[model samples]
Target: MLSIENSKKRVTIHDVAAAAGVSISTASKALNNTGRVGIETRERVKRVSVEIGFRPNALARGLLSKRSFTIGLLTNDTYGRFTLPLMAGVAEALVDHGVSVFLCAIEDDPAMGQIHVEAMLDKQVDGIIATGKRIDRSLPVDLSNLPVPVVYAFTEGRADSVSFRSDDGQGAKLAVEWLSRIGRRRIVHLTGPEAFFSVRERAAAYSAATAHKEPVLYGVWSESWGHEAVARIWSAPGEKPDALFCGNDQIARGAVDALREHGIKVPEEVSVVGFDNWEIVAAQTRPPLTTVDMELKELGRQAGLTVLALAEGRPVEPGVRKLPCRLVVRQSCGGQPSEK
Candidate 1:
């Protein structure tokens, strides 16, 4: 069914052979890095192949290796806020390894999760990376007994599975430290509901860093809550805070708006730092925002590599692994823009 034009456009091993000034068998051996060949000649052949944009047939390569060269990413993050960057990291990590990904959006549906799992199994995916919107919660379906290797990223899983997450406490500490370094004292912590484990971890870190005298404020993860918290904190004006550490960007943005209404200048009057350096929210703030980034993409890259290692019969220690978070500096906290 291949058209003549398409057939002509396809680059074959013969083309590599011709370009590399080698026989077809020699080209194949050089390309696969198998059989005896001169080192210089092999390098030349590879360079030429790359220059010509030659790509081997993946189906044929998979057939020889008995690996479908595919992976499955199962997530309950329907909004893709967490999953999108994670998926990009996974795909980028595996592209050179000749593996593709199948994304399954389960969206808190047990039946849907089961269906996707079964489908990935049917396709013989080498492994699966289970991720979600939050690290505190697990996906609806069971992954403990799956046939393939499973790695958890930004989500809870079985106790013994290899997992990756951002160091929430450390990230919070970073934010607090940044505020202190900028000579802002009287810091106050405003965060989400107490039910989430991250909220507690962040609050504890904030307390340790500041020996926080003021009580921690817990509310819904929303801009409205941020606005309300600001109002309450300013109501009793006995020595107001010079800095506000928000749990997320939404709350920070709301706090900034409320501060504006109160005629308080940002950074100059009260430096504001937020978590989850969500670009859309943080970068668009009046002076931009200084926030902590969980590095979810890097977590995904590590998770991808770990799952692939397991699939390739390599041993990896199983337990929860906490990756580091980074502080992205912007104008909100009187910091220069991040170079990276």
Candidate 2:
């Protein structure tokens, strides 16, 4: 039971122990959810602590535990397109455990990357999560043998390191299969350069889904390419494709605009689906774009947890973790309604 203590004074573990009629060590174990304490005693101790407004000092706890309870996020993605959502996920996963995340954007500068890495190490960060704009590329500075645990998210990682990335093939298959379910045939793939690893993976999936009936149109990841590709397809001597699957939301927006200009009714005539469900492009399109969401936030959540586990001296398997994708339905695909 909670005793009548001075409300103005800072309540420490001793106060909680006295209020709950338990020893200091038992109170500590109960509060931290460690050691073998009876359920009733643990509950009583926690209840008394809350009732007495007891708050643990984070600095003192860290010093005693020999852990900073902080993580560093190192990224080259200055645009924050992917990093923002991923950071949100990491923060969400770690906040409950009193963990703070420090974000450092190195922007492809090796010197700056090294400087930021050194600063994080100086601050005694428990772990680091390396992320980037693309999955096939690594950050400029090497993080091979740091003193802390390193986890990779949406970036190239070492062969033995644990990494997390969205499954491009799965995302492509989701888009293609959604179009197929809506009775779209002769689907043409308008995507970015074939040199990109993601482009190749998506193209392979598209080919397998479509049975190689149509060739993929590879170009830059731009709206102009999408527009020009549409013009070229419409001007061809063969039958027009009933649907178009773009590599990204920007391309999908361009395709939709071009179709509108060419007097082709969207969905009614040619359904369109895009990848990377980028809201800026997907949500503002004429009829709104139905795209594949890579679930980067969930990937970040998993990466954060993995790094935390490593920091806590827990075992984790070293390999690439591929998260599945989900299709966001919208008017562009003539779907029932918009669903993310």
Candidate 3:
């Protein structure tokens, strides 16, 4: 039988141990699954704690274990275009373990980044995950010798450290192959600047996938660039490309709009594919884009777990991990709406 007054009071580990007929140390070990304890005794303590609504004090646990059960997420993607989805994944992965995430956006300011890093260190964060707008660039602040473990996601990292990013080459190949599969013989690649590592990688893959038959248009990552590229190609072309594989959804949207203005029908006379299946841009496009998804959320989930493993003293091989990308089909590609 439960007493109303007792239920209203906080159930401490001491009360749990008392109810389970175990010592305080034993109860702690059982609840945390730390020290070796008899299986039956551990089960009994856990059952009793649940029945009594025993919730361990996070601060007390952190003090005793020298672990804050918190992670710091540092990013320069102030727009939140990439950071927000990745943050959600990190939070989802850590929430089950009673871990919290602290987010800091520095926006390319070294001083601000250093300040945020110091603050997170002051808070005794268990680990830190550094992310950014581009994978070729590093954060403004130095994170090389931090006391806490560091994991890099969607950003450049030290050669000796662990990092995660999408396989841009594979993603580009997927896009090109899809265009070829739908009987589109001539496919043009409209992408961002050649200086960008991702742009170069995707361009190489696009060339190989198309047998070096199509032109690779290097331009800025903007809808205006997409529109201008279309105008240039159509004006001085032998035969207009039957398909356009863009660097991003924005470019794809612009190309679609230009094609529409030129009295061209998408998926009927021309097919368009894009990278970065950003819903805000991809879904809202006139014909909805068939694009490549980098799966940033899954990348974040893996990065979060890797950092947690490091914080827990678990061994993890350090290297750049390139997760695979998938193609999302929509009305623009002359295919049934589906995700691959």
Task: Provide backbone clash counts, one per model.
Answer: 0, 0, 0
lDDT of 1 by residue, 1-340 (tens): 9666754587888899999999989999999899999999999999999999999987676677767789999998999999999999999999999889999999778988898999998888899999998888999998878889999999997888899999999999999999998898889999999899999999999999998676789998999998999999889758999999999999999999899889899989999999999999999988788999999889989999999999999999999999999999988888555665
**Tens digit per residue, CA lDDT, model 3, 1-340:** 9666755777899999999999999999999898999999999999999999998888887887889999999999999999998998999999998789999999778988899999999988999999998999999999988998999999999999999999999999999988888889999999999999999999999999999997799999888888998888888948899999999998998999899988889979889998999999899998899999999999889999999999999999999999999999998989566645
Please give the ranking of all candidate structures by TM-score, highest first, separated by commas.
3, 2, 1
Per-residue lDDT of candidate 2, residues 33-139 (tens digit): 99999999999999999999999987688778778899999999999999999999999999998899999999678998999999998888999999998889999
The lDDT per prediction is: 0.91, 0.93, 0.92
**Candidate 1 to truth, TM:** 0.86
Off by over 4 Å in 3: 1-11, 14-53, 336-339
Count of backbone collisions in candidate 3? 0
Off by over 4 Å in 2: 1-55, 338-340
Model 2: residue 150 alpha-carbon error in angstroms: 0.7
Q: What TM-score would each prediction reach against the true structure?
A: 0.86, 0.87, 0.89
